[model samples]
Target: MNITINRNSETPIYLQIAGTIKNMIEKNELVKGYKLPGERQLASELGVHRNTVVKAYGELVSEGLLTASRQAPKGYFVQSAVNSWNFNNRFFPLEKMIRYHYNEREKRFQEIFNDSVDKGYISFGGIVMDKKVNPAGDMGSIVKHMLQFDEDGEIMSFYHDDSERLKKNICHILAAENMYVNAKNVQIVAETNQALYYLMTLYLSEGDSVIVEEPIVPDNASIFRNGGLNMVTVPMEADGMDMDKLEMQIKKHKPKFIYTMPNFHNPTGAVMSLSKRERLLEIAQRYGVPIIEEDSQRDFRYTQERLPSLYSLDQYKSVVYVDSFTLTFPYGVKVGYVVGPYDLVDMLGRLITMTETFVSNMGAYMISEYIERGFFAEHTKRLAAYYSQKLDLLCSQLDQIEQKGITYQKPQGGILLWCTLDENINERKLFLAAKEKGVLMMPGFLFYPYGYQGRGHIRLCFSNVSDQEIVDGVRLLGEAIDQVKTKENCDE
Candidate 1:
C-alpha cells in the first residue's frame, strides 16, 4: 500500500498516517486482506518516528477499520472483511466505541460479584450503601401515611408531573442548600437517570458537541455518546475542571452543553472551588452554553461548611440543576428534580412528558413527607458523620499498601475514591482477578467516555462495606494487583 505523510501540516503525524490509510481504504487502493509495510519500514518510508507508525496502527484498530492477528511472528495485515466497510453507514464512531467497550467494564465488575458469590467470598463491589444507614423505617411510615391519605385516586393514577405539594417541599430543600429557586421553576419528579436523559435529549442532537470532565460519571458519557453527540473531555484537577482547557475547547467546539458534577464529583470526589464555580459560569455565559450541574451528592458533604451550588451563583440563570434522593435516603425512592430557567424547564418538561409522561406521584409524596418532617436533613447529617469515619479508616488501610505501586486521593465527600496502579498494572485484568477473590471494584476506565483512556485506574466505594470488610477487601485487592502485575509482566 502507498501512503503519504505531511510533516509540515498542522495535523499530528500519527493522525495523518491514519487518515491516509482511511482514504486508501475508501478509494479501494488498499484492498481487503492487503498487507501493509512493517512498522520500522513504514517509519522509514514516511520519515517519522516508529512510535508514530505504531500509534497510527493502534488508532486504526480502535476504529474497527483494521484487524491484527499473530501468525508465528507474523506482522499486521488488513482484515479481509474490509470490503464491507461503510463509513457513511457507520453509527457515529465515538458512540460505537463507547457502547462496545464501556459495557465490558461493567460486565467485568459484575462477573467479580458472581464469582465471589459462588465461592462464598465477601464482595465489596457496587454502590450498595449500608442498610443501617438507610432510614427505611421512617420511609415505611411515610408510605403508610401516603396510603391512608390516598385521595382522589391519585396514588393509583399514572401522572407525570409531581404533586404540587411535593414540588414546594423540594424547593424548600434546595433553598436550604443556598440554591434559591422557585418551586414553579423546578420540575418535580423523574428518576435522576431520566432527569439527565431528558436534559440531554432536549439540548443535544446528532452532530452536536458537549464538554465533560475527563473522568466523568461513566454512564452519563455513555448516554451522551450513544445519543450521537461528540463529547470533548477536559481534565479535572483538584480544584475542578481545568478552566483553561475548558475555555479552549469551548472556543474550538462551541459545544451545546457542559455536564459537570460540582459537588463530590463521581469516581473522584474533587469538589469545585467557589472561585472556579464563578469562573465556570462566566465561561458558560460567554460561550452561550448551558451548564448541567449535577448536585446529587450535596447532602453528603463531610466538612463543616457547605459549598454553594452553581444554580445559586448563576445570576443569568444559565445553570440547569439536577438533584436526587437515591443516594441519600432509599434507593427505591426514584425521585429527582431539575431546576433551570423557566423556558428551559418548560422544554425539558415537555421532553419528559413525551418520554415518561410524568414521574410517580406516590414516590414524590413519600419523599415530600420525609422532607416536610425534617427527617431528610437529620438523617443525611448522621450518614455524613458515619461515612466520614469510614472514609478515614479505609484511606488509612489503603495508605499502608505499598505506595510505590499504587496511587489514590482522599475524597472529602461521596462514596468513591479513585486509585491508580503502576503503569505496569492493567486495571481491567485486576478487576477480573479481584472478583475471583471475592472483591469487586469499578475499573477507572468505566468513569471515562473513552473506556481505554483510564487503563490503570479503579474506583473503590467505602460507603457500603463494613470497617472490617474495608480492611479485608483492601488486602485482597492488594494481592490481586500483585497477581495481575505478575501476569502482565510474564505476557510482556
Candidate 2:
C-alpha cells in the first residue's frame, strides 16, 4: 500500500505503480494472499485517476503477480511469495538500487548443495581438491619460512603495493606449459571466478552478447547472466563445442568475445582436440573476436595427450588467458591471473584496484615461493597421478552400470564426469532420489544458460571424494537410477 509515485519521471504513473507493487510481491513484502488496496482507494491515495490504478492492477494481474477476485468487494491478492527474485529483463526501472543480481538457479543449487552437505550426503557435487592430495603441510612450511625470514614484514602485513613477484612467477609457470608471456600482460585477481566476472563487467555492457559452451560451469553461466550478457550457448560434442553451431551463433549474435575452457572443460571434462583448438583459434581470429581462454584445469591432465592451449597456438594475439591456482592448490590459495594485451591488463588492474583494492598479496607470495622452490611442478605431477587413479576407478564403476542406461565418455583429465541419463529417466526425480540415497550431484540443466535441453544430463565431480567414497557414491547413483526406472515402470 505504501507506493511512491515520481511525478516527474518519464515512465508512466501506471507502470511505476505496477512495477513497485510487483517488486513488493516478489520481495515478499506483500506475502501470498495479501490484499491490495482497491483501485479507487489507491487512486485517491496517490492522487491519480481511478483508471490509472486500474491499469496498474491489470498489469500485475496479467503477470500473475496478483489475482483479482470477481466478488462484489473486488480486491487483488498476492499470488506467490518468492524468496528469490527473478527478473527476466535487465533492470527494474523503478528500483535503481538493484543494478544486478545472482542467477536464481545457481542460488537454488547452492541451497540444495548446502542442505545435502548438512545431511552428510556423499558429495559428487563440487569440483574441490581432495584432502588426500592437499599440499597444506608444504604450503604451511613455506608460510612459516616466510614469516621467520621476513625483515620488512611485507609477507605478514598488508604492506605490499604490487603483484610483480607473483606475475613474474606466473610467467615462468606458463612458460613451462610453452605459453610464454611477460609480467606486463598479467593482472592478478582473487580467483578465476573473479577474473571472468571482472572481465565481463569491464569490457561488456548489459545486454551485450557473448558465446559460451552449452553446459558451461554453472558458476560461470551465473556470472554471465548476472552481468546481463545475452549468452549464446553452443552445445558440447565429444571433442568440444559444436564448431558449426558456434560459428552460426558468432555470426548471428556477434558476441563481444568468446569464452572457452578449451583444456578440460568443466562438467563435461572434454578436452578440445588438437584440430578443434586450431580451428577455434582460426575462427576467433577470422571474426576479429577476442577469446577468453579459461585454463583452470590445464594442470590436471592425466591420460590425455596434451594439446597446446589456444593462447599458445594463437599467432593473432586474439586470446586472453585466465587461470587459477585454486584448482591446482588448496582452495584457500585464491590466486588467479589474466594474461592479455598490455592495455587490457592495465585496465583490468585498475578495475581490480578500484573495486577490490588489491588481490591477496599473501596468496601471491605463497605461489611465488612454491614456483621458486620447484614445488609446483612436482605437486601437479603428484595430482595428475593421484587423480588419474580416482578417475579410472570412477569410470570402471560407471562401466558396471552402463547397461542400465547411464552413459558417459571417460575424460582423460580434469575433475568431473558429464553423464547422460536415458531419455525417459526423470532428471528431477533422479536428483531427488540420489539425495535420498545420501549422494549429491549437479543436474546438467543448471549448467545451461536457461536450463534448455539439459534434462537428461548430470555432472559428477570425482576430484574431491575419496576412492572409497567415489565407489560408494557411484553405487548410490546407480541405485538412484534404478529407483527412478522402477518408479517409471510402476507409473506405466
Candidate 3:
C-alpha cells in the first residue's frame, strides 16, 4: 500500500492517511478483504508517528470501511463484502454536515449549564421573547377565558381542515403586511417548524435536490437532509443570496425547490431587496421550481420599510408561504399557517393529519381570537419596537468595545447579529472559554451546514439579554478572546 501525507495542509496527518485509504477502497484499488499493513510497519514505511496510524485505522473502523480482528494478533483488514451494504447510502450527508457544526456547541451547553435550572447567565444564544415586551397579562386572561369556555364545548375539541375564523384572521394579517390573499387560499394551524417539514416531505423525495442559502437555519438543513434530499447551498452577500450563484445552481442542479428567509435572513441578518425578490421569483418561474418563502422574521424588522413577501408578488402561485407568531406572541403556542395553491394546501393538510393527528385546535382558536380582537397586531408592533431599542443598545455597546480584531454587522431588524472575530481566533475555543465565564453565544458555524466555514464568527442574540448584561457580556467576551489570542501566540 502507498500513502502520501501533506504536513503543511490544514488537514491533520491522520485524516490525510485515512482519506487516502478510504478513497482507494471506494475506487476498488484496494479490494474487499484486503489486508492493511500492520500499524508498526505502516508507521515505519510512512515515516509518521504510530499513533497517527492508529488514529487513521480507528477512523476507518468507525466509517465501516475497515474491520479489526484481535483474534489474529491485532491486525486491520478491509471488510469483506464491503459493497453488500452501502454505508454512505444510508448516511445523510447534509444532515451530518449540519449536525457536525452544532453538536460540539450543544454538548458544551449541556456540560456548562446542565445543572443550573434558572436563567441567570447572559444569554446571547437562544431565540427568546422579551418578557417585558410581550402582552403576557392579556394572553394569560385569554387562556383563562378559553379554559372557562371549555364547559360550553366551544373550546375546539377537533381539527377542521380550514379553520374559517383563523383563515380570516391570517388573511387580514397578510393584508396589513401588503400581501392580499383570500382566506379560502390559506391553510390554518400548524407549527412553523412542522409546516416547513410538511412542505419538504410532501414536495421532495430521496435523490431530489433543493437549493438553500449558505449558513441557513440548521434545523432546515437537518430536515432536508434527513428527508434524503440533496441540499445545495447558495452563498449569501450583504444583499442576500448571491443571485448569480443561485441562478447558476438552479441551472446546474434543476432543484425541485428553493427555500429562503428573505427578510433578516438567519445567521447573516441580510435582507433581500425588493428588486432581488422580483428577480428571485422570475428566476424560479423560469426554472419552473417552486419557492418556499419563509417570512418567519419579516415582522421583526427594526429599520427601513418592510419589504413585501414573495407570496405577495406571486401571481403564478409558485410561492409556498409559511409564517408564524412564535417569535413574537408566544413560543409555546406553536401556531403557524401556510398560504399557497389550494391543491398544495390540501396535500400538506393530509400530511399534517398523518403526522400529528392534526394541528392544535385549541391553540389555533386562541390565536384566531387574539388576532380578531386586534391584540396580536398591537402586541407584535410593540414587541418589534422594543426589540429595535434593544438592538440599538446592543450594537452601541459592542461599538464602544474599541477592539481592533472584532467585526460585526448592525442588523436592522432581527434578534441576532453575526460577528466575525480576528482570523487568528477560533470560535470553538472561544465558545468553551465563554462558557467558563458564564456568557453564552451561538457559534456561527452552527448556522451553516459546513463546519469550520464560520470558524471565526459567532452569533449574539439581543432580544433576550438585558441592556446591562449585554454591556458586561461583551466586555467579558473581549477579555476571553484576548486571553485566547495571547495563549495561541505563546504556544506558537
The TM-score leader among the candidates is 1
127 Cα displacement, candidate 2 (Å): 1.8
Summing lDDT over every window of 10 consecutive residues in candidate 1, give the lowest-scoring window.
85-94
Per-model TM against the reference = 0.76, 0.76, 0.75
lDDT of 3: 0.73
Greater lDDT among 1 and 2 belongs to: 2
| C-alpha RMSD in Å of predicted model 2 compared with the true structure | 13.3
Best by lDDT: 2
In model 3, what is the error at residue 203, expressed in angstroms?
A: 1.4
Give the lDDT of residue 8 in candidate 2. Answer: 26
- The C-alpha stretches of model 1 lying farther than 4 A from their native spots are 1-121, 136-140, 149-162, 451-455, 486-492
Model 2 lDDT per residue over 1-492, tens place:
788664422246788788778657755688888888878889889888999989889988886778999996568989963323221212111111115566656875676656544428788886656667876337767777656445775554443533798889888888978888999999988889888887786678787778998777767877777777788788788899988778766765677788998877887888888998889988887776789999988888886476888888999778889998997778487888899878789888877777765577777777787888888888899999988888899999999988777898888888788888875566667888998888888877677654342236778887667778888988888888888763232211
Clashing pairs in 2: none
Task: Give the C-alpha miss distance for residue 461 in model 3, angstroms.
Answer: 0.9
Per-residue lDDT of candidate 1, residues 326-416 (tens digit): 7786657677888887877787666666656657677787777777888888888888899998888888888888553677778778877
lDDT of each: 0.72, 0.77, 0.73
